[model samples]
Target: MSSEIAKYVSECFIKPKYEVQEAKQPYYLAPMDLGMLFAHYIQQGLLFAKPSNLGDEQFSIHKLLQSLKDSLSLTLVHFYPLAGQLTSLMDEAGQKCLVYVDCNKGPGARFIHATLDMTISDILLPTDVPEVVQSFFDHEGAVNYDGHYMSLLTIKVTELLDGVFIGCSMNHALGDGTSYWHFWNVWSEIHRAKAGESVPVSRMPIHNRWFPDGYGPAIYLPLIQPDDFISLQEKPDQLRVRIFHFSSDSIAKLKAKANEEHNHNNTSSEISSFQALSALYWRSIIRALNLAHDQVTNCRLTTNNRHRLNPPLPQEYFGNCIGALKTTTTVGELLEHNLGWAASLLHQSVTNYGDKVVRDFIHRWLHSPAVFKLDVLTDCYSVMMGSSPRFDMYGNEFGLGKAVAVRRGYANKFVGKVTSYPGVEGGGSVDLEICLPPHSMEALESDEDFMNVVSLPLKG
Candidate 1:
C-alpha cells in the first residue's frame, strides 16, 4: 500500500453470514467467462463527503468499518460465488481441462481498512486523477488469472480526513460490469437497512453461467499454469488520466450532427449518443497522432451481448456475456471523413455484430480457449472504450450519503482505454475517463475540435 494514499490498519477475510452449499459440484465457468482469463481485475471506487455537522474527531471509523463488514458477510451469503476461488478442474487423466469456481468452503473475500489524510476536494477537483487513488484497491495490477490463488473479491475502505473512499477489486473472470454492480447494490442495500432487519433485494444472482447453443457449460483449456501469463500482463507506460465531462445537450448535438451529415446517405441507422461521442474521440485521436495516410487505426469496444443473442440471455445472468467489437480503417480514411463517417463505421460494426456473429465467435473460441491479452495489438494503432455510462455508479449509498464521484483504481489501464460514467449532474450527461500517454494527452487537451464540446474547462 502507498503511504501517501493510506496508513494500513488491518486486514481480514469476511465469510458468508451463513453456511451455503449452492452447488454440489464446482461452478464451471462458461465460454464467455473464460474470454477474460488474462484481463486485469475490475477495480472501482466511490467517494462520499464526510457526514455533515461532524468533525473528523467525532466520526468513528471503527464503527463504520464494523457495520460495512457485517453487512458484507450477509451479502456474501447471497452472492456466494464471489466468496469462492477459481481453481483448475482436471479429468481422470490428471490434466487440467477447465477452471471452475470452488464454492465449497473457499476462502472468503478480503476486507481492508486504511486511513488517509486528504479532503474530498483533493480528489474531486477534476484535475488529472490523483495518483494515490490506485493505492486504494488491493491487487492493483493483478490479472483475472490470479483468481486461481487470490481471493476473488477485495474491498478497501480508506478513511479520509474529510471523506471516505470505498474501493472494490473483483476478478474480471468472475463477472462482467453488470454482475459486479449487482453485487455492490446488494451489499449496500443490506448495510442500509434498519438494524437486524432482513433485506430482500429486487435483483439476485442467478449463479448459473451461460454457454452458446449446442455447447455444454464447461469449456476446457488444458494446463493453464499461472507462469504462462506472466509475460501477458500490460507493460508499464508513462500515462495520464483525466475525466472529461459531456453535458446532455452536447451529447444531443453530437448525435444530431452525425445523423444530419451521414444518415442522409441512407446507408445506416441513426447514430446514437455513444456512437457519436466515440466517433468524435476516434477522429480527434487520429488527427492528434498525425499518422501517415495509409497508417491503420482501430477502435475497439466491449459491447454487451446479453441483448444481442437471438433469444438473448437473461439480464440477471451472473457471468460475463460480452463480446469485443473492433472497427478498422486507415488514418487517412478516418481523419479525412467527417465525424459522422467515423461514427457510422462504429455504428455499422456494432449493428452487424448480432446473434449469428456472437455464436460463431463463441464456437471458434470453443476450439482454442485463450486469455484476452495482446495477441492483436501488434497489428494496428488502437483504442478501447469500456465501463458503460448506464451503470448506476452514484446510487449505492451504503448508509453514507450518495457518492460525490466515482473513480477507477489502477488495474487494466492501457494507453487508450477510455472509461465512461454518467456525469454527476445526471440528466443523460456523461463523463469520459481517458487514459493516455502524456504526449497524446497534451495533444488531446489542445485539440479544438474535441475540446469544443467539453462541458467544462480542462484542468491540468
Candidate 2:
C-alpha cells in the first residue's frame, strides 16, 4: 500500500463479536436481468461522522462496533441474500451458466475494526482524491466471491481522531445504488432504535425480482464465459480524481443559460438542472482533453428505470432497475453548439425512456445472446456519468449522528467517468467526482468556463 494509505489504516482487525451466521434457509437469488450485468463490480462508500457529536460517553469504538455487528445480524435477517455468496450453476439445458446468490453460505458480512491516526478534515479537505478514504474499503483481491460465491457485503469501521468512518462494500450484482442505500438506511434505523423497538415497515426491503410475464431465470443467466470477465479499458497511468462542488446558484446560472439559448433558437424544449450541468461537464471535459474535432465522442447518462417502467416497480425494489441514455456526436458538434444544444440532446434522450421504451430495452436484453456489458469509458474522449445528486447521502445516522460527508471508493477510477453526490453542505448543491488523465485534469482546473461554476475549495 502507498504511504498515504498506510497513514489512515494505522491498525485493523476483524471483530469477532458477531461472526456467527443467522440465516436459517438458503434463499436462492437469480438476479434481475440488469443485476446480472453488474455481478462482477463492487460498489463502496465511506460515511464520516465528526467526533464532537459522538464523544466517549455517547459513542466509543467498542460500543459502535458492537452496535454495528448486532444491527447487521438483524438487518441480514430481513436481507438474507446479503449473508450469502454469488455462485454459478448449470441451467436446465445443461449449459454451464447461471449466477445466483446462495444464502446457505456460513458466516456473515465481514466486519472490521480499524483506527485512523488522522482527523476527518485531513481526509476530505485534500484537493485531490484522498488515498486514506479509499483505504477504508476492502481491496478487490481480498474477496474473490464470483467463482466460489462468498460474502456479498463487507463493513469496515475505522476510528479517526475527530470522527468515525463507516465503509461498506456491497456486491453490485445483488443491488444497485438504490438497494445499497436502502440496506444502509435500515441498518442505521435498527442500530439507532431502542432494544425491541420495531423498525418501520417502510424501511424494510422488497427483494422479489420482476420480469416480463413469460421471461424467467433462463433469460437472466450469465452469458460471459469464465475467462471473459468484463474489465474497463486501459486508463492513463497518471490519472487524477477530484471533486468539484456546484452550488445551487451556479447550477441555476447554468440552467438559465441553457434555457435562454433554447428559447433563442425558438425550441419548445426546456433543460433541467441535471441536463445543464451534465452538458457543461461534457463540453468542459472534451475541451480540456483537446480531442480531434472529428472524434466520435459519446455521453452516457444512467437513468433509473423504476418510475419509467409501466406499473412502476415498488420504490423498495432491491435490484438494478437502471438504463443508460446515450448521446453520440462528433467533438466538433459538441464544441460548436451552444450549451442549450447539448442539453437539449440530453433532455431528449432521458425523456425518450418511457414505459414502452424501457420494456423494449428489457425485451432486447432478454433476447440478446451476449452478456450485458456496462458501458465504461473506452477512450479519453468517451464520457459516462452516474449517481444522482438526489440520493440522501447525509441522512444515514447510525446512532452516532448523521454523516458529515460521504465519499465513494476507488470504483470511479475509470477514465472520463463521473459520479455526482449531494453536496455535504446540502442546500441543493451537487458534488461532481470526476476522473481523467492528469494532464486533462490540470487543463480542466484552469478552464475558465469550468472554474466559473465550480465553488472554490473551503478553507478552515
Candidate 3:
C-alpha cells in the first residue's frame, strides 16, 4: 500500500465506533425475506486520460484498499437499529457491513472477500474530472449484496470503461426508493466536502413512525404464506419493459370519454390520465390472459403513500411512501361493460386509499405480526401505475449528448408495471410506461378500441 493510501486507511477505519447484533425486524414491515440484505460500493470507478507531462501517474490498488479500511471507521459512530427486517435499513456499523471484490482479472467473473471495517473512502472517486465522476455514477456495479450488509468493489484505472456505475445495493425493506436516493445524494455531498469542496447544509431525514392499516371495505386478497418468497423467484415471463409513445390528441379523447362516463368534470387530472390508459391496457391484458370469460382478474395501481398519512407526510420525508391498490374485474365484465365502469372502479380504488385508509393501514401494520403474503396476491396482481413527467433522462450531462436511451431494466416476470406520468406538451398530456408479459401485451397492442381511446389528444 502507498504511504498516502495507508495514512487514509489508518484515519478512517482503524479508529471508529462499532456495533454487532443479531439481525432482527423492526415495526415498519413491508413484504420481505428474513435474511441478511446486501449491496455494493465501487472505488476509483472512472478512467481518465493520463496527464501528458507526467509519463505514468497512476494510483495503487493495494494502497487504495488500505484507505478503504480506514474510511469504514466512520460507520460505527452512525449505526441505528434495523427496522422492518430490511437489511438495507441497518444503520452503518462495523460488523458484516463491508466486503471486497476484485473484478480486475475478467468479465462474467470476479472474486470477493470481506474487509474488517471498509470505510466509504475505501471506494475512491476519481480526481481527474467530472467526466469520470459521471462514469463512476453511471455504470460501475451490479447486485451482489447477499447475506451481508454491504460490500465494496474496487477497480483500478485500467479496468474502467468510459463510464461506470457504482452504488450500493440495499434491501428495499431498509428504506424506500426515496430514502435510497437521499442517502446517495448526501453521501456525494459529504465526500465532496471532505475533499475541501464547500458543501452546504445537509438535511436529516424524517424517521418513519406512521403505520399502514390493511383494513378497508374488505376486498378479497389471497392470504400469502411464508414460502411465497421461494415461489416469487419463478416469475412469469412478461416482466420486461417496453416503451410506447401515444399522441397527445389520442390521450385527450380517451380522458374525455372516461370523464364523460365517470362524471369526472376535470378531464385534465393526473388521476384521470393514469386511469384512462391503465384501463385500456388492462383490458388488453385480460384478453391476453385468456380470461375473456373469467371476471375476477384485476389490475393493481401503485399509490404514493405520501398524502395517505395523518396530516400528510412531508414530501421531503424520505422513505417508501408507496403502496398498491387492486381493481378487480373479469374479462366478461370489462368487455361487457363500458370503459366508464372500469374507470369508476379505478377511481373508487384510489379515492378509497385517501388519508383515512392510509393512516389506518400504517397504524395496524405497526401492531400486526400476521405477515402479509405477497405470493398468493401475485397470481392476480394490480397493474402498477405512477407518473414521472420530469425525470431528467437527458439531464445526465456527462459531456456526451444527453442519454439517448433511458431504459428501465425490470424483468417484472409475473408482475404488472406502469410508468410515471410523462405530462403532455405544455404539461397537458399524460404519458406512461406499461410492462406486461408478451402475450398480454400483444392483446393490448392489437385492440383497436383500446388504442383509439388512449390516442385522443389533450384537448380532444
| Tens digit per residue, CA lDDT, model 2, 37-77 | 43344555655565554444655677767667777777776
Worst 10 residues of 2 by lDDT: 11-20
lDDT of prediction 2: 0.71
Model 1, residue 321: displacement in angstroms?
0.4
> What is the TM-score of candidate 2?
0.89
The C-alpha stretches of model 1 lying farther than 4 A from their native spots are 1-3, 53-58, 92-95, 195-197, 233-235, 375-380, 457-460
Q: Residue 13's C-alpha lDDT in candidate 1?
A: 92
lDDT tens digits, residues 317-357, model 1?
Answer: 88898877999999989988899889999988987999999
- Give the alpha carbon lDDT tens digit for every residue of 1-460 in model 3: 1112111111111222233232122333232211111212212111122122323544443443333333223321121222111122222452221111111111211112122122222223221112222222211333223212222212121212132122233344344444544443443334334433223435555544333345321111123232434443343553434445466667677777777776654444343766776777676556655653754677776566666666787754644566667787777887677776788778778777777776565555534423334454456434555434433222222212222222232222234556643433334445455666656666666777765555432321
Which window of 10 residues has the lowest lDDT sum in candidate 1? 371-380
Q: What are the models' TM-scores?
A: 0.94, 0.89, 0.56
lDDT of 2 at 69: 78
Ranking by TM-score: 1, 2, 3
Q: How displaced is residue 248 in candidate 1, in Å?
A: 0.9
lDDT of 3 at 33: 16
Clashing pairs in 2: none
